[model samples]
Target: MEDRKLTVRAVERALDILLCFTRGSELGLTEIASQIGLHKSTVHRLLTTLEEKGFLIRNPSTEKYRLGIRIWELSTHLPVFDESATLLLPAMERLRDRLGETVSLYLRDGFERVRIQAVQSEQAIRRVAQIGARLPLSVGASSKVLAAYAPPEVLRELLESAGWPDYVERSAYRQQLEDIIRIGYATSFEEREPGAAAVAVPVTGRSGNVVAALSLSGPVSRLSRETLVEYAAVLRETAEEMGLMLP
Candidate 1:
């Protein structure tokens, strides 16, 4: 069978409009239209359709559009971000207690890694990666772990979206990520944020696909490279055990 030559111009335009409203900037129809180079009427029609479907909503007072709760509901069904987090939380909790360091379950969300669940360590000096915190995928132990295990296509897509940032040299970052995959885990100190250090290992599903990452983090002094390397074995063991228990 041959593929059909289908046109998705309108659909692509609608998605582009939705992408414009990110991180608290609710956009008006004209703004969205201008950004996407679509006529106001076309954008309005697309927005109205999306609003009726509960993917977008209009503010009566400001007349601006923002993403609706339904999108959040749908996001919860993503197996990697939601189910993997739920499945790994118990193991993460136990690992946190055993290691006496912050433990987090993370999954790739677009160009960032999202901390779906984090157990803060009860130590005099500890690192804190808040739940829902988004970190760039090209930096840090958790992010590197996720990127190292991700499919080639997915990693390519994320890098393109992230653009070329100079925070870290691109070639060195790529080499680091390659080393992470070779070692089956990753460790970083003060890469994404100052005063933080962490190590992370990939968590695979029963089908042997990387679904999430498990990490232990703390202050650089406490979670030194040697300490992180020591805990890396524990993280890998715990993640493997959890993978076997998932449905």
Candidate 2:
């Protein structure tokens, strides 16, 4: 007989329910159950357990559920999710201090890149990335670097799923990936959102695989082609340093 699984899938489902609340919303039980495809009773059990742990709170009058304070305390040790940012913040700070530009850390999640950490420059003009913001895979410097350096299977799946929409369909997205590989970084402007220009470089683990992307972002006015080229080199060096420290 196969070895018994260590953890119950119900517990996993419950955790997923808690994480979904990270969007900062109040959701009713039906909505939560529907999202995760669990029976009402199952979701209720999960919610009750989570509530006991202070991970979820149910409104008495509204019957809505929202994340609880215990999650904040529990999440302090989420190294896998926060490691890219936590490990790189000091370097990002230094980059901002030296270059007077904003810096952010991104990691690939399925077909998207998520900005986990960002620090703004002290300059009168600055760029900011809202933490937990998600960006599509087909656009922007960070996404390109992620695509280029990601595992081959991940790259293939991401490109296949992205569907090459007209927004990025005009550009040779494949060729762009090739260039990102050859050049060791990527630069793009207004591809995902207008007026934003960015440069991104890969952060490699000890095994020499890219695990994350470190990027500099600002308005196109300040981050011209020449400026981006210069920033790319800085980003690559910094990211390489940060990657070595990863567990």
Candidate 3:
């Protein structure tokens, strides 16, 4: 538990096991051991400890492990979430009300995008972005904005890895990222979910580097191209104000 260089072996291995799920939502004992290069016995023991601490859960039927609610609880405590969520709630609510759609704030975490704050539409049927939800950084408008603005090496690594859809050409994908930056926003239509559409703008920190994405989401039936274009302008302006509040 020391802040110094000496990392406790058991703790390190436990953290590594938790990280294994970042690639996939669930993993069996053998799969985890193979990925982390550890023995089944060691993995099982660590998994047991993690489960007891409420950090992981095992499905009784499938026997696969997945991250537990404790992870979600911890995510709420992250400094970025703690600070930004409260600071931006008013803006998100206003944006949501004005746009008549769901507005969400997404933060990039590893190869995933986390929804730290959200204001849902008043309509009976609307897109709901769950707080603490972790989604692939390869899809959706917010995901594109977040990944596109990540550090160069990080973006390059992502571009060469599992982020892009198999059918999308790499060269064109790179240009799209450039366009998102040059145009100051991004858009996705049913990329992550069927019938869903979204527009995103970058939220920068004090460093003038993108720290998160502000996205408005709705059903395709409502968010037509013209509507999205108008939404982009509002979102871009709101994102700029939100960025000023970020450290």
Candidate 4:
């Protein structure tokens, strides 16, 4: 019982320290201690712990603490139907309605992409992807969009694991990723499944990382080059709106 109390106290103190910088971009040790009402030594120790765990980073030049990338990275893994998804559903539905195509929300899962939410098209001959379906991040428009924004380490790991097409050269694939980043979206025609085409845009997080991909898919005949470009513009617009809603 005593040990549990101590653990709770430590957690509370750590959370307090984290909360101190919420109102500001960064905070010094003394400022954090004063705000959290903790001793300077205790605050320093907590800061060191958080820094070691990648939850905080100390600026060498300013000697102040700021939230770290790990926080944003972790935020990307929140539950599929969490607040971010809830906020995105209506927009996805709207897109599906507008284009009469299936729309999906895909999140990166290592060398794979998982469809977390989907709005299927009403057309009798429309493309459809199941929610909670895990697909390889090597072939689809959604895959390319996620891979284009994935960290270099992730891309290297995927390549090292033979997660790319044997026909495509590494340099060419890298160039494709660069083009996706530059053009703000990706498109695939019968890349994953025959007769299917998709256009996907990156859904960025507060830190500007591509946390998810919003895609619209349909029959190849319906998603021609001109139609694909038109759909990509709409998807990019919706994705931008969705990114603004992420934490």
Q: Is candidate 2 or candidate 4 better by TM-score?
A: 2
Please give, for residues 71-164, the per-residue lDDT of candidate 3 as tens digits: 9899766786657688999989889888899999989988889888889899888997777678877778898898788989988888788556
Q: Rate the local accuracy (lDDT) of all candidates.
A: 0.81, 0.81, 0.87, 0.87
lDDT of 2 by residue, 154-243 (tens): 777766673656656534888999988888989988776688788998888888778788888888889998999988888877887787
Better of 2 and 4 by lDDT: 4
For candidate 4, lDDT tens digit of each residue in 35-117? 98889998898899999999999999999999898877986777654666777899999999888999999999999898888
- Give model 2 RMSD, 1 decimal: 5.2
**Once superposed on the true structure, which residue ranges of model 2 sit more than 4 Å away at CA?**
1-71, 81-84, 162-164
TM-score for model 1? 0.66
Q: Which candidate is the best by lDDT?
A: 3
How far out, in Å, is residue 107 in model 4? 0.5
Clashing pairs in 4: none
Cα error, residue 59 of model 3, in Å, equals 12
Model 1 CA lDDT for position 82:
39
Residue lDDT tens for model 1, 165-239 = 767776687788899888888998888769988899988888888878888888888887888888889998998
- lDDT-wise, the better of 1 and 3 is 3
Query: Considering only N, C-alpha and C atoms within 3 Å, which residue pairs clash in candidate 2?
Result: none
